[model samples]
Target chain A: MTRYLLRRVWYMLITLFIIATFSFFLMKILPGSPLNAEDKLSEEQKEIILEKYGLNDPIPVQYAKYLGGLVKGDLGVSFKFDNTPVTAILFDRIGPSALLGFQALVVGSILGIFLGLMASIFRNSPIDFSSTIIAVIGTSIPSFVFAGLLQYVFAVKLGWFPVALWGEFEHTILPTIALAIHPMATAARFTRTEMVEVLHSNYIITARAKGVSESGIILKHGLRNALIPLITVLGPMAVGLMTGSMVIEQIFAIPGIGEQFVTSVMVNDYPTIMGTTLLFAFGFIVIILIIDLLYGLIDPRIRLAGGK
Target chain B: MSKLLEVKDLKVSFNTYNGEVHAVRGVTFDLNKGETLAIVGESGSGKSVTSNAIMRLLPEPHGFIKEGQILLEGVDLAKKTSKEMQKIRGKDISMVFQDPMSSLNPTMKIGNQIMEGLIKHQNMNKQEARKTALELLTLVGIPRPDVRINQYPHQFSGGMRQRVVVAIALACNPKILIADEPTTALDVTIQAQILELMKSIQQKTDSAIIFITHDLGVVANVADRVAVMYAGKIVEIGTVDDIFYNPKHPYTWGLIGSMPTLDSTDEELFAIPGSPPNMLTPPVGDAFAPRNQFALEIDTVMEPPMFKVSDTHYAATWLLHEDAPKIEPPAAVKHRMQGFAQTGTKGGGKR
Candidate 1:
């Protein structure tokens, strides 16, 4: 197991390196420069600014410099954020994004799983029908649309919370709901499909024949088996949630990594854009690793297979 | 022996999108303590449905006991609520299914699967259940109970898994163990071992077994009494010797004739022509009439009642009628019967 994990970590490093290289080169190919917005500055002044930041260095020299900084765990300074260190700015913006993401994920997963379980247990009933309807609507509609509707209903008309601006708990509510719906739907849909299949399996019949209580059968045998596939879908969904939703952050005026990413791209802030992309890639790879480990824990077949 | 279970005119049906499928139409039988009664039939013959109905494990919202009584120790199990059945299942009645590959839960350890019933029905504490589970593993001939108990179902081979399945079914020492083609998924050698294990276990516990299988060879090996199902009804039922030696119903004759015997020199084996009738619109009168080569004219118009051949034998066929003309069984079937009589040995009945 230790060897397997160490090998996976090694592969992860290669994957991250490939991603870092691609994103860096992809930014260089974009049409505009970081100084495009500085129209009021004279040509000579712009050159001085470029020289100071070493932007006049040839592509290979600049690339070499970037790699040097990366090896030392430095993400360089943001081009447009008052020259702030990219890491410090990222650390600052990450709090609200992580908080909102975590809240949405926890709430969404719990509600979605509950909905799915109910649908499967009471199959073909009104509850099942309604749960299906909820899943369809949840997945079909975009998060931003839900954000707009939530703001209109709760903030504009009902006055249940503030309209926008991030401050109190109430301010966090609408955006979280918006971001939560998609995952909730995805989880519900996946859980229902997997559970429905599992509940009808021969083992379930064996469980019933063993005179296991209905609840016991559903929770222990049914849910445990169903969870394997659910985790597959939920793992990627979780990474997407954890990184923050850009449109949602913008609409809610929440100072999050997603909004910072958008602003960085608009101003051609290379370091901040690279930092955010790398953060998302890192989260995705780690989540995939965690998912692999979780599979071994949940299913012994996989666990033993990996041993050899 | 005292009667352990009595299934009287038990009818089962499933509601499908096309229509209601009358899977089991008025089947009746009784099982005595310490005996294995094998219900033998081809696919869609309703033998499995009858066993599932007894345990109240039929698929819900569709498959159900349409009518009749499943009397377990004089108490009607057919009338028991789902909640009530929960207490009776795994404790009083347990079942081993056809496919051992899928019968045991993959996520669970062999020990926990065995312990589940003990912990639930017998109310055994964790430690006690664990001990009993180990004993069950040992009883089923699985080596190293200590290590095997902690292992999951996938670790075990097909035969080993079936043994684990048997261990789980036997955990609570159920009075009635319904083995629904338990050896169907096993190889011939492993099938014999599982049969032996079950027989030895029955001897120790005195649990009555309702063994359901389509294999006559298996029936002869394990069943004291055999009930031959055709469509949704039992067309012939008697001691194992009676079904094999003096099968009266044409369907039963067809079944025996189809099996390949060890010494048979025939160019081709006999196969019952045509498939079973669709349950969506079950044919009138005898369901097996179309397929029975020796089917009488009355068989198509009127269903034959179970005529008593002896105190322990009965058959549902017009051929047994006093007024009907005497017609002997086919030459091949007759030869097989005589072969068994002289040798005092059973045919392999290999498909």
Candidate 2:
């Protein structure tokens, strides 16, 4: 098990290194200046500005210098925003987006599992049919569009809550629902599919024949086996929501790292972009690793088979 | 031995998109304590359906008991609500199914599955159930019960897994243990071993077993009584001696003649001609009439009632009717029966 974990961490480091190298070159290739003070600075002053950040060095030398700084946990500085450290900017803005994404993740995944389990248990009934339809609509629409619809229905028509912004619980609810709909739907659909298959399995029949109650069978046997495939999707779904929250943040006008990321990209802020890419990639890699371990926990057969 | 279970004119059907399939049509039997009643038939002849109906384990809203009384210790199970049935199951009656590879919960420890019934039905606490689970594993011929109890289903081999399943079924000492083709999915060697194990275990518990299977060879090893089924009904039922020594139903004769004996030296093994009739629209007459060579004219229009051969034997065929032709069973059956009678009894099966 430790070997499995060690191998995953090794892969994570390699993935981060590749993303860092690729993003560094990709940023250099774009036709824009990170330091936009060329007009105000004399030629010598501009040279000083470029030399201070090692932009005047050859690409390889700059790349080597950046790697050297990365080793020391210095993610460089943002050019578009008053030359602030990339780590500082990230640390400042991480809270709001993480909270919103986490909120959406909890709401969407919980609801989806409930709906999927319901659909699978009472299969072909009206509840199953309607939940399936809802899941379809959720998967088809983008989060922004979903946000707009939620806003329209709750904010404009019903006058139940605030339309946008983030502070009070009411303000976060609309955006959270919008962000969660797709995952909730994905989870519902996948859970339904997997739960249906597991429920029909021969073991389930044996459980019923042994006179285990229906709820006990569904919970202990049916849901546990069903969650394996569901686990595969959950990791990616959370990362997608965390990164996907950028567009959502802009629409709802929430102050979050998502807005910082959007502005950094628009203005060609290399350090901020590199930092954001590495952070999100790191999040994804770690989540996938956790999911791999969860597989062993849920099904001992997986670990035993793999060990053998 | 007192009667343990009784089924009175049980009928089961499955409602499908194509319409209702009358799977088991008015099958009746009684099981006595300390006995094994083997239900034998070709596939789709309702052997499995009849067993599942007794357990009430048939899939719902589609397959159900159309009409019947499943009287366990004189209580009508058919009239009980599902909540009440849950209490009856696993305590009064437990079942072992075919396909051992798929019958056990993969995520659960084999020990827990065996313990579940003891905890639920026998009212044992976790620690007590755990101890009994180990004892059950040992009783079913599983080696190293303490170590094996902690292992999952996939950790065990196919035959070993079946033994574990059997251990689970026998845990609570059910009044009747219904095993639906428990060895059909196993290897031939494993099939014999499992039957041997079941016979040995049967002596230890008073639980009357209803062993459902298609293999007559297996029936000889484990069954005290045999019921040969065709088109969802019992065509012949009698003590092992009566069915094997003086078999009368044409279907039963066909079954016996088609069997591959160790001593028989036939160039081609006889196969029962034609498939079982589709149960979607079952025929009005004896369901086996079309396939029977000696089928009388009346056999096409009317179903024959069970005819008594002896106090302990019965067969559902017009050939047993007085005034009908005194035709003997086919030559192969007479030859096999004569050979079997000379040998005295099946070797190494009786406890």
Candidate 3:
């Protein structure tokens, strides 16, 4: 297992390196300047600024310098953020996004599995139909749209909570719900389809023949098998939620990495853009690795394969 | 032997999009302690439905027992609530399903799969159940029980997996073990081994078994008695000797004739002509009439009642009627009948 993890981590490093290199060059190729101080500063002043940040060097030289800095764990400084280290800025923004994303994931998976399980148990009934409708609405409509409606109904009309801000537990609920709907819906649909099939599988009949209580058969035998497919989707879903919360964060005024990522991209903050992109890529890869590891833990068949 | 299970006029049906599918229509049989009663038929002959109904494991809101009673030691099991049946299922009556590849839960450890019933119905603690599970694996002839117990179902071969399934069903030492085509999905050689295992296990446990299969070869090997079903009903039931020798029903004759004995030189194997009637619009009289070559005029108009051939034999056919012509079985069928003694002796000697 340790060997497997070490190999995966090695692959992760190689992947991050490729992504870092690609994004750096991609940013350099874009038709814009990071320091767009046209007409505002004298040529000497602009030259000084450019030279200070080493942007005046040849593209290959700059690329070599960036790689040198990356190897030393330095992501350079954000040009638009008054020389703040890209890493520090990202670290500051990640906490809120991480908390919100984690909350959304936990809430979504639990509620989704519960709803899906109920829908499957009482299949062809109103509950099943309603969950299907819920899944459709959750996936079809955007989170920002849901965010606006929630703000209108609960915050503006009802005066139940703050309209837009990130501070206490109360403020987290609205954004979390908005971000959670898609994952919750995805998990629900997958869980329902998989659980329905698992419940009808030959093993479940074997369980019933073994005198397992109805709930026991459904929970222990049916749900465990159903969860394998659900877990497969969870990796991409989680990363999507974390990175996809940019619009939601903007609407709610939540200071998260997603909003920073958007701003950094718009202003051509070279270090910030590359840093955030690398971070998202790193997160996605890590999540996928974790999900792969989780598969081994849940299923012994995979565990043996992973062991070798 | 004392009677263990009795089914009287049991009818099962499934609700589908098209209409109600009368899967099992008025099937009745009785099982004695320490005996294996084989229910034989082609696909969709209601054999499996009958077994599932006995276990009360039929798919709900669709397939269900529509009528009659399932008596276990004189208690009406057909009337038992699902909750009540749950208690009786693994403790008193357990089932071994076909398709070992799919029967065992793929995600579970073999030991835990066997131990589940021991823990649930027998109320054994984890340690005791574990020990019992190991013993069951060993009993079913699984080598290295200690190691194999921790392994998942996918690690085992199909025959080994079926042994694990048998272990799970035998965990509580159920009085009535319903094996639903248990060897149907196995290799021919593996099928023999599994049958041998089941018989050995049965001799040790003395559990009455309801063996459902379409293989006459398997029937001759394992069964004490045979019940042949057609469409959704049992058309003939008798001692293994009676059905293989003095078989009265044309369907039974077809079934026996269809099987190729060791010395049969025939190139084209016999097949019972015509397909079974669709249950959605089941015919008015005999469901097998269209398929039976010996079918009489009255067979198309009215169903034949179970006519007693001897104390231990009964067949549902108009040929057994007093006024009906005494027609002989087909030449191929009579050939199989003549060769039954050799196969029967071989099967008994092997056991």
Candidate 4:
């Protein structure tokens, strides 16, 4: 197990290196200049600005410098946000996005599992049909569209909640729902498929033959086996929720790293963009690692089969 | 002997997109107390279906007992609700299936699986059920019962898993234990061990066992009476001696002839000529007529009713009619039958 984990971590490091290198070059090649804006500096002033942010330096030298700063835990300073250090800005706003994303994940998984189970149990019934339709809608529509529709209904029309901005628990609702919609739908559909397959499995038939009640057979045997597939999606779903919250956060006017990320990208704030991208990538990599470990824990067969 | 279980006119069918597939058609049998009745058939012969129908464990939305009366000690199980059936299932009647590796839950500990029925039906507390489960593991001849109890199903070998299944089945001391191809998935050595364990356990519990399998070799050792099924119906049923030595049905003769005996000199074993009839639109007459070598003209035209060969023997075949020709069995089968009869007593095989 230790060897397996060490190997996985090594692979993660290599993956991170590749991601960092690709993003660095890709961002450099993007059309707009980080310093040059429609309403801003003249040519010489832009040259000075570019020099300050290492944009005037060769791409290799700048990448090395970026890597050096990254090693020192200093993500440099943002050019678009009055020269604020990227780390300081991100640290301040990360709490709301993390909280919103976390809530979304928990809510989505629980509700998705419930709906999926209901759909499987009452398969071919109206509940299953409607749940399937809802899942389809949730997955098909983009998060931004769902967020806009939710804002219109709950905030603009219903007047039940605030239009935007995070304050208390109530402020967390819309953003979380927006973030949760796709994952919840995905989890439900996956759970339904996995559960249906498990319910028809020979083991479940044996359990039923053993005189186990229908509910007992489903909960104890069916769900336990179904968890393997369900756990596989949790890693990507979590990362998606965290990074994908950008548009939803912007829509709700919430102060989250996702919103910071979108603005940084728009104005070509190099330091903030690099910092946020690295953070999102790091978060995703770590979550996937943890999920892989969890796979071994939940199903011993995976562990016994010797981790893939 | 008082009848412990009686299955009357049991019919099971599956509703598919094409139509209703009649899996088990008008099958009937009776089990007395402390008896071992083996239902023998090839694959897809409805042996398992008849057993599942009695337990009401057939998969829904596709399979259902179209017509049947499964009476346990004179109580009609068909009329019972699901809840009522649950009450009777583990406590009164239990079943062990083929492929113990798949039967036992991979995630659950063997002890927990055994104790589940004990606690649910026997009203035993956790501590008591745990103790009883350990005792059962030991009873099923599993070595190191104490250490083995905490281990999951995957930790045990195939044979050990079957023992665990047996332990769970016997947890509530059920009056009837239905073992559906229990040894089919195991190796030869493990098969012998499991069959021996079942026979020993049956002696201790005095329970009627409904053993379903395709192997006549297994029936020779474990069964008291044998029911030979073809298609969806029992074509022959009799005491082990009657079926083996004085076999009357053509299907029975084919089955016995097909079996590879240790002393046989033939290079190739005999096999029944054709595949089983399609259940989608089953034949109006005898289902096995197309496959029977000794088939008569009436065999294709009309379904034959079961004819009593003796007080303990019965077979369904047009050849068993009073005016039918006295046809002799194959030479090899006759020699084997003669050998078996000379060596064995009235009750030679153990349950």
User: Which parts of model 3 are misplaced by more than 4 Å?
Assistant: A304-308, B343-351
Most accurate candidate by lDDT: 3
Query: How far does residue A211 in candidate 4 sit from its true spot (Å)?
Result: 1.8
Candidate 3: clashing pairs of residues: none
Q: What lDDT would each prediction earn against the true structure?
A: 0.90, 0.88, 0.90, 0.87
Which segments of model 1 are wrong by more than 4 Å?
Answer: A304-308, B346-351
lDDT of 3 by residue, B92-112 (tens): 999998999999898888888
Worst 10 residues of 4 chain B by lDDT: B342-351
Model 2 chain A poorest ten-residue lDDT run: A299-308
Alpha carbon lDDT of residue B216, candidate 4? Answer: 83
For every model in order, the fraction of real contacts preserved is: 0.89, 0.70, 0.86, 0.52
User: B26, model 2: CA deviation in Å?
Assistant: 0.7
Candidate 2 docking band: medium
Q: Mind giving the per-residue lDDT tens digits that candidate 2 earns over B18-102? A: 9999999999999999899999999999999988888888886699999989898898887887778788788888888899999
Candidate ranking (DockQ, best to worst): 1, 3, 2, 4
Candidate number of the best DockQ: 1
* Model 2 Cα lDDT, one tens digit per residue, A75-153: 9998877889999999988888888888998999899999999999899999999999999999998889988888899
| lDDT (10s digit) by residue, model 3, range A184-295 | 9999999999999998899999998988998998888998888889999978889988899999999999999999888887888999998999899999999999888888
